[model samples]
Target: VRTVKPELVFEIGFEGINKSSRHKSGIALRFPRILRWRHDKKKEEADTLENLKLLLDPSNLSPDK
Candidate 1:
């Protein structure tokens, strides 16, 4: 196995996001896949962990808006 530094950032698509104790981020993504390679973006420009956590909000998951 080759170990590579965290340099590349990609946009990921997922069916759902949920809180999970099994993950370090305390969040889990269902059916995740690489939507696109963000070549134009730098690693520093990646989405923040807080932003991802926002998806866990109950209001955001509500079927009725």
Candidate 2:
């Protein structure tokens, strides 16, 4: 098993993203899994918030459960 740090990048698979009052980013991941470490890439090359938002299903953006 590989452990990821804040400065490292992980290929994660999650069910969805949700609004979160507790997180600084105001978004949370549902049933997230750390699939693997992106060893060939640098941390700076990791996905950004915009990248994540772009991948989100627009209709599912609402926080309502």
lDDT of each: 0.79, 0.75
Model 2 RMSD in Å is 4.6
Clash pairs detected, candidate 1 = none
Instruction: List RMSD in Å for every model shown.
Output: 5.8, 4.6
Score candidate 1 by TM-score against the native.
0.76
Q: 1-65 in candidate 1: lDDT tens per residue? A: 24557799999999988777666766778899999999999999999879998878585453322
Q: Estimate each model's TM-score.
A: 0.76, 0.67
**lDDT tens digits, residues 1-65, model 2?**
34346677789999878765666665778999999999998888898877776765667666643
List where candidate 2 sits over 4 angstroms from the true fold: 1-6, 57-65
Alpha carbon lDDT at 33, candidate 1: 100
Model 2 clashing residue pairs (backbone): none
